[model samples]
Target: MHIESDQEGYRSCVNNSTSCQAYITYQALQDDTLQPVGLCFRLSVEQLAEALQIAQYLSVALDLFTSMDCELSSVTYIVGLKACRGLASEKESDKGLYLEKGITIHKGVKEHGFKTDIVVATNFLEMYSNCSSMHHAREVFESMFSQDAVAWNTLILGYVENGDYAVAMDLFSIMDCEPNCVTYLAALKACGGLASEPESEKQHHLQKGIGIHKKLQEGGFGSDIVVAITLVDMYGECGSMQNARDVFDRMIQCNAVTWTSLILGYVGNGQCSEAMDLFARMDCE
Candidate 1:
């Protein structure tokens, strides 16, 4: 009876304070004491686990919760997947465990009927990609009923991060959705990576980088500072110092990275005098 009173009092406290509720949920999940209250409350617990950064415990809680065949929400799946991603970023030994949990949660997402939610699907794509599970990521991407620029960008960036620049470029070319700023950014990164490949691959990537630059200008991203800096870096890397200078001169505003890129471009082209002149101008500004 005393324990029951304490439980009631605690419930009352949780009811009155949002932070207290999150704390209790977090503690319950952490201790593996969370009962099958309902799907909504279980999801709240999962969210609290995410907020508390106890990703390993979150994965365990998710496994325990979903095994009971409890109803699942899109929020539950997304948060759980995010927690798995967090765990995957930890030590190598934990990757197998987290990856297994993540796969189970992926299956649960389908069984619990969230397969059609585009946002959830996109997050699944990102989670799998970050975990170095490209096969699973591609599976999620292909399973989605609808694809948006965000989804495409996620997969493209995932490929880029995995050092599969060629595959990333291939995906970009086949994307039905229009590329956004992030898409362009990832494509530029892939271009940079491609430029560093063997001699046979160098000219091809440079041309691709130039093509992407033209597309950025046409798409009205010409003035984006990051994009402009990327263009300068790309041209510099490709040994096109004149193109790099052209981009640097057209910038409405130049940051440190922009200045460094052009300076290095001149130096890389063996024009030390021009590089010094540019450095002097930068110092004056």
Candidate 2:
């Protein structure tokens, strides 16, 4: 919780307290009521875990849920798991505590027979991933009756985080569907984690990365500048300066990352003058 006093009349708010119950819960969570600490949490299910008023938030959610008369589905579980993320971020001890809470809620949803729902499975995978339990995430993912790109990406991300780049790449290889920008980004990051190969062997991954880039273009998913930047980094890291330059030149707009990667690539190749020039240009921009 935090507070601020400005030139205008003092105004305060709790971060995730968009609703009245949220505000009440925020106030109630802390022992001190007269002096409310201004705190803001992310306004999502994962973030809601930190609310001072868990019961209130749940009550509000339950009321609206009942009023709508919509069946509780996997979507609800996913949302709540997402809120767990916020709670996890609060502290290291809190991270495990919140994750356990999220798991319990997810288990309750499953006990009610929504276990087959993909969204719920995805959320479970996500929660487990955040909890640093890739094995649990994989278990949930494998049990999923329905899976989609997001599910794949979540698992891929978990593998990447676990430093199992080879397994991440294998997952990518076995994916029977086309990779999206997010998928490609995760794979590219995994490539960075891979063991250092000889220049010749590194060239193979470079070719594959370029192939993926072309596929992205052909699929018309060109708006992801992160993908473009990662390509430059991948090629540069692999000692392929020419390919790095090609990608750098093709970008229509250059952010700090693009400029830095290009500069670093030039520096890595002993092109000090070119790197300096690029750095100067970035400063001007």
Candidate 3:
């Protein structure tokens, strides 16, 4: 009887884990006392999975579920993919197996005629991105029949996170959807990444950064405090103190981040005196 009850509990746990996780998350948000409850649950999952090699069981269950269900929902795939991603990161030897499982699910999604589902595609793209599989992410993105701003932003940020700044810039240029604030911020980060390249590539990236800066202004993001601060930092990192200062001077508001970016830019360029002056002004403010 105990064994049968335990088996029932395992089945229930597998079926209801997602809801349990959601409830735990809500509890944590609503009450500070519940924060440790969520953390403990997450930590226990990892520890239990490690002890019992649960990834193997999960893979088998996923295969069975997919085979039995004529049409798998996007949410199901997303949850499965997330689990694969977590397992992939846990051990080098397990990475290939989990990645292959994710790829299988991707193929299944297409074969089962859910390819046009944007949420599913985005979740698939994000799963690949999180797993450091940019090539797969790009493939999923490019295959989308219609892309949204969020989808475009996801791929753009994915490239930036993967250190493929050049591709991120190219993707940004061809994006059919209107770029959002997150898009602009990710592009700025790509420019910053470019500035860190070798001397031979430095000027080329600086020019690209300047073009993005112009776009930011035209898009009316010039006054956004975060955007303005990013511009200062980008120009400073590229050794363009004059342009950085030009942006700083135009800002209607200057926060601590804005002041710090300029000061660091001056310091980076070996202009300690100018940095000191800016620090004094920042202190006064």
Candidate 4:
């Protein structure tokens, strides 16, 4: 069997292990063992982590550039944040240091005055939120004179994650305008966390949820597989299998999520026979 030129070139590079003058190509292979440009680009970007490691080995600070601009790209800043967070946790002696680094970078950005840049601001909020520094997240949020839905959603999510659902709901309610799909999803999850509810209270939240669902459908988010799956999961957890099933049945294309949610809904609601029937149908599909 004869090898193709690209394969031959790859093999030659691997054998020689020398600096290459030719424009070398690399790719990511999927499970079926085919390669595509889309996959290759994804793989290349993923390799940045490994490249960072190699740069470390060479005693190079990848973030340090001698150029006057000296600006790091957003991706590089995020990667730096990840690296700092990863180390700041494992090295117990470095306690308070990761958050310090995050604060420092954020301060530098502010002193340099990219404070108004939404991308940088969002990254700062994410770093603080992930570091379990809700105070810092709040400061960052409050510093912004104006916020789009993304900023509001992030803070609401942070509050929910930090186990302050009341604050999350309060912030959610007082927002100047209606919540977007992501906001609705987060709010629904928080509402579903209610352990025990009086029948009247349950009806209130359920009605609110139904209203959100209607808004979602009107906003063209109803057909989103992720939103649909989340609705199914939420309704199932809340003992609303009928609602879950309605969502599932409405899906134009059912994937693993739709099938799993249906099975889960029946199992959760103690409808074992229905769960088993769905499983059988899924297997046939």
Which is the leading candidate under lDDT? 1
Candidate scoring better on TM-score of 2 and 3: 2
> Which residue pairs of candidate 1 clash?
none
Instruction: Rank candidates by lDDT, best first.
Output: 1, 3, 2, 4
Q: List the residue pairs that clash in candidate 2.
A: 2-38, 15-39, 15-40, 16-41, 45-83, 46-82, 46-83, 46-84, 47-83
lDDT of 4 by residue, 1-285 (tens): 112325444344323332221112121222235332333223333343334433341111122211113344445455555555455444557637677877767766766667787767776776676676889888888888788889888888877766676677788888876679889887766655541244446556666567768878989899999888878876776677888899999998999878998898789779999999999999999
Q: Which lDDT tens digits does candidate 2 get at residues 76-95?
A: 55556665654454455766
Task: Estimate, for each residue in 154-201, the C-alpha lDDT of model 3 and write its tens digit.
Answer: 999989888998899999999998888789888888988888777677
Candidate 1 local lDDT, 1-285, one digit each (tens): 122335454444434434445545545544444443554455444455454444245454444445444566777777777777776776456767777878888888888788889998988887787788888899889988889999999999999988898999999899997888889889988887787677677678888888898889889999999998888877776777888888888999998889998999789768999999999998999
Q: For this target, which candidate reaches the highest TM-score against the unseen true structure?
A: 1
Off by over 4 Å in 1: 1-25, 28-36, 53-70, 90-94, 260-285
TM-scores of all candidate predictions against the true structure: 0.76, 0.70, 0.65, 0.66
3 or 4, greater by TM-score: 4
Clash count for each candidate, listed in order shown: 0, 9, 0, 0
Which prediction has more favorable TM-score, 1 or 4? 1
Candidates ranked by TM-score: 1, 2, 4, 3
Considering only N, C-alpha and C atoms within 3 Å, which residue pairs clash in candidate 3?
A: none
lDDT of 3 at 105: 87
lDDT of each: 0.75, 0.66, 0.72, 0.64
